[model samples]
Target: MDTSRLLRTTTTVIAAAGLLLTGCTTGGSGKLQTAASSAQPSPDPTALRPYYEQKLTWRECGVPGFQCSTMKAPLDYANPGSGQDVDIAVSRRVATGPGKKLGSLVVNPGGPGGSGIGYLQAYAGIGYPAPVRARYDMVSFDPRGVQRSSPVECLTGPEMDKYTQVDQTPDDAAERAELVAAFKEFAAGCRARSERVLPHVSTVDAARDMDLLRGVLGDEKLNYVGASYGTFLGATYADLFPGRVGRLVLDGAMDPARPSLDLNRDQTAGFDTAFTSFAKDCAKQPDCPLGNGSPEEVGERLKDFFRKLDAQPVASGDPARPLGEALATTGVIAALYDESAWPQLREALRSAMNGDGAGLLALADSYYERGADGKYANLMFANAAVNCLDQPPAFSGPDAVDSALPSFEKASPVFGAGLAWAALNCAYWPVKATGTAKELVAKGAPPIVVVGTTRDPATPYRWAQALAGQLDSGTLLTYDGDGHTAYGRGSDCIDSAINRYLLEGKPPQDGTKC
Candidate 1:
């Protein structure tokens, strides 16, 4: 994840009892049902004890070519009939020309903060192979505290701009004080704006919310594909609802067994791996601007450039938008996540070295989701709130942060320090984390496919390996590419396997690497 556009991934472990809240539904995670029951009236809330709660009614809303509606759930499932309610937003793409559609297939793009509905509309809706989309009604939901289904808001645009620009990796007491003050201000803003919702948006709560979506969608079991942070969300679902599992896919996975500190450090190293790839590729190109040298030399040069920019921002041709260290580092981080953008990165760097930052700025803008009118989306705020609520920050204090700097710098000297600082956003979060680092053992659960890309800078390939090792029935699929995720990144072998599984219930053999 990067600054300005997103912070830490919102997905985290289950919280303590106080911060953790159940979804307003009728079933508990321990056991839902082996399979779908006969089509009948929804379960009675009063009939179920502390576990299951309210019955859901599917209705219609307007979205053209798709069905849209809200599922009424308890604001807190632990107490249903208490006159409190929360709305869950859902959208479904009905199965195309039939084969007696198998069931609903839910997809998440993994921001914990990613817009599930928006991802469906953009890539998964139509870009997914035809055979898969044929037998399954592609569905996506905005989890609690997400975009459509009631969001969490904090700082204003101007305030946010200042927060984003704050020096995270400070060198002196003054700089450290400045950093702490910025964190406090950010925390206070979130506390003031989203006091009640802050404690209730952990990943476990969101995972429970998914089970409700599955039940409401009328699916016998969960059929899902979650990427990046979505992997954490999917695993959490399995840990809680293993019995209700169906065909689930977790691509570009994260290691649930690792703590926030390790997670952030690993991600820092992941970026280093990505930049090494870019450096090697750049050195081979005739148009290389950052000098055609070894990867180490290339990295050092980038660090020098960043230092130069930090001291004196480049012209960038836009007086209103200076190309400072923050923006420059953000631009670099974006390229690390996906190799498809490597060529663009090289070009941007070429232009930047010539004192033109327009190209790099555009790349950074996309990752940040910045609009032209000097306005921004609510992504960053929600990202922090959800993540900070899930688990404690990787950096809790100055000493801990200082200790990790060397390792982070070792990963991608150009990017490590800034990312380490970015981790500080949640250090002063309004809500306390309810979850911790633990393995997700989906014992006796249905087959779950785990995909990894060797050069994925966001979620490392090893994460998929570890996740597959942890899950009782996880099938490993390797993309052998440079990108944040494997699916839809152009691989015939990968697409065909997923299509067969969705359309014919035939998953690729376990440990199949592309």
Candidate 2:
């Protein structure tokens, strides 16, 4: 786990508690139950009827090809008849086809907080394969507490700027105290500002909202393509409504079986793996900033650079802001997301090493989505709120983190300590966790395709394997490549496989290697 991965929430819906189970035992049958089976009413389905039967009013959105709408879901599903309602923002581009339309294909990007509406308009809606786009309406929604939804707002732009610069790899008592204070202030801000919405934005709650969206759209089943954390959310929906699944693709899948601590640790290791790959590639390039050396040597050099920044910050060409260790590490982590960003990262590093930190600072700011006017988006705030409520904190405080430092360091000597400290952000959360880690067998569902990139830095490949194994109807598709995800990233094998599943309802065979 890097600092971003710690604070950022990926979209997934595994119960936070009692997350472990031996194997998939859903419905006692491996195959999907009848579609009619999903219609079986609950003992108290009356409370949900209003939500399930409500009509949607879609209108022209700002984007030329997209339509937008608002729908309401119970703030608390357990008490839908009594609690307040939260608004959901949805966007869609109807299929433009020369063939019969299959249905709506809902797409989600990783941040549990990533705006699905934005993803729909900017990427999946127009950028998806032409055949698939022509046959399936591309759809997306802002999950609760995400942008355009009932978003969770916390620190202001200035406040967030200060928060991001706080020394994560504290070297002394004073620095540690400052880091602790920053975390406390951030946690307190979220509590003060978003109390009502904080407790209800759990992944489980979002999954339930998806169910209502399904009904509102008049779809008998859901067709979805979710990446990174989105995989978790899609799987959770399947777990909650197994009979309503159709053509589900979970790319960069997460293991619902692991606890938060293990997830963080494994993610720490995953980043190390990705960085090593980056380093290996860099060594082959003449302009490598860390020098053309062995991976271990390069790791040491980068660590040394971070250590130097810890003692004395460098000018980033911004009078009020100087490049610090935390910001530099964020810049590094941002590049790990995509190999295409490698050249930019190299330039950023070269600039940083030459006493000019502007490039690196810019990269870090981009990762945090800070604007030129000092305004920050609600992405990080919502990410922390949802992640904290989804699982128990990895550590309670600095003391607990100190005790576990060795394990983390062993996981990734370069990024270990900073990630461990970042994990503490959830410890002081205002709301108690509403869910826990739990197996999502999603039994009695149609075959779900689980895709994994071998060198993905965020969700590890083993997690995809575990998730596939846990889901009774899961089929594993492996992409032996680098980067955070496989599909739609210059991989014909992956795109063809996933596209076929969505357009033709034909999932590729398990263990399909690309």
Candidate 3:
């Protein structure tokens, strides 16, 4: 849960590469200027538009149940009158059932950069609850620098291998220097590879893109559901186009009013909280590896074990592969995303401590999406690019991170400053941020539901409260449990409440804790 926040002054906010954790860029007035481009930027398909506007066709593409279409909007919206066009890839699954159909519903699964098109095709278009699915034409697309539309790529497979293996929690000067190199190389790769598209991928730009998509789809109002970073995207759309909103739902929401360092620090604390919960449960189980002890004791033992591994690396049963900091940290990050995986995490740790690295490596592989053949997806690369583009990393240099260690360690004695410094990956982003933090008031928009899971590690629950508070028409629905999101993680009460809202536009009672 990234908290996904930025600090604001009056109505303006300092923009960086997305959410400033604690230092999301405060006290700056208009450092990053908003684009003054026209609001009607749609002539992008052709350099010479007015002359050829009459020639372009908008026929629907055949995709079984979906209605696919192509749209040309400005690659840069500020100059909508410009002839340079950016084609948008769009798809919609129209509702078909005995009951009357609702207009449309857009789904976003937050990475500030995840592929909405892929999410739609894989999950929302079909995996959404049947009743809700039958009433709305589900829609999705790849945002500017995302997949399918026009992706922002950075590293090759071999280069990426070195990048993911960088040690975050450096023990010696050599290790620390290695970490620095990794960060610099990653930033350099983006600047070198994605320079053309990096500067234009800000959240504001994406939100405006949404507004244009809303128009081309023939909808006067937009209905949507966003989670994690998606919450920030939805909130931004509401801020920029308050009047065009309809039935918006922001779950696993991010706070839109914090800086980068604080955001990451809070998440550090959150993971600590989750670890504490996991520890308590583990100690009560018979298979507990750290032995039967108090939760705090179990945590202390785990921390000591990690320290031991840091000093002397463990053999992970592979000749060229070793279980190092990156893999270990990722294993923990993955566990934090899903509560259902906690017991598995405990077992993984137990096995790892006994010279068996397979279990821990498996968890790490899932987080990194590593394959048996050693092939890796573009998830981390895209994540770093989108995140770095959204906001500057929380810290700028290794010295700064070193100085901030005490506080980060206090935040999580186990994770410590490594997680804090990991937040600094975007501090030196090649492109500048074009968007800033702002409370989306959606003053006259229909009631939007903001859902929160009590112990969600990736998107902290408190953020949902913050987002709900900012939106004038937002109501809170609490899922008193753990995990990144509550939707399909299996709580009848949570699912039913959200389903009712999407299917019937019936918001659950405010402050209703499930």
Best by lDDT: 2
Taking the candidates one at a time, how many backbone clashes does each contain?
11, 15, 27
Worst 10 residues of 2 by lDDT: 14-23
Model 1: per-residue Cα lDDT over 446-506, one tens digit each = 7888888898888888989999999988888888878677776788888787777766667
Q: Give the Å error, residue 331, model 3.
A: 1.1
Please provide, for model 2 over 58-167, each residue's C-alpha lDDT reduced to its tens digit, 9 standing for 90 to 100: 67776777788887878877677785988888888899997998878888886767778767776778888999989988888889998778889999988888898899
Order the candidates by lDDT, highest first: 2, 1, 3
Error at 50, model 3, angstroms: 8.6
lDDT of 1 at 85: 56
Q: Give the TM-score of candidate 1.
A: 0.88
Tens-digit lDDT track of model 3 for 238-318: 876677887888888888776677777777777777777777888888898877797678878887777776766577776
TM-score of each: 0.88, 0.92, 0.85
Q: Can you give the lDDT of residue 107 in candidate 2? A: 86
Ranked by TM-score, the better of candidates 2 and 3 is 2
Residue ranges of candidate 3 with Cα displaced over 4 Å: 1-71, 81-87, 371-373
What local lDDT score does residue 351 receive in model 1, on the 0 to 100 scale?
A: 82
Task: Please name the candidate that would achieve the greatest TM-score relative to the true structure.
Answer: 2
> What lDDT does candidate 1 reach at residue 233?
88
Candidate 1 ranges with C-alpha deviation above 4 Å:
1-64, 316-320
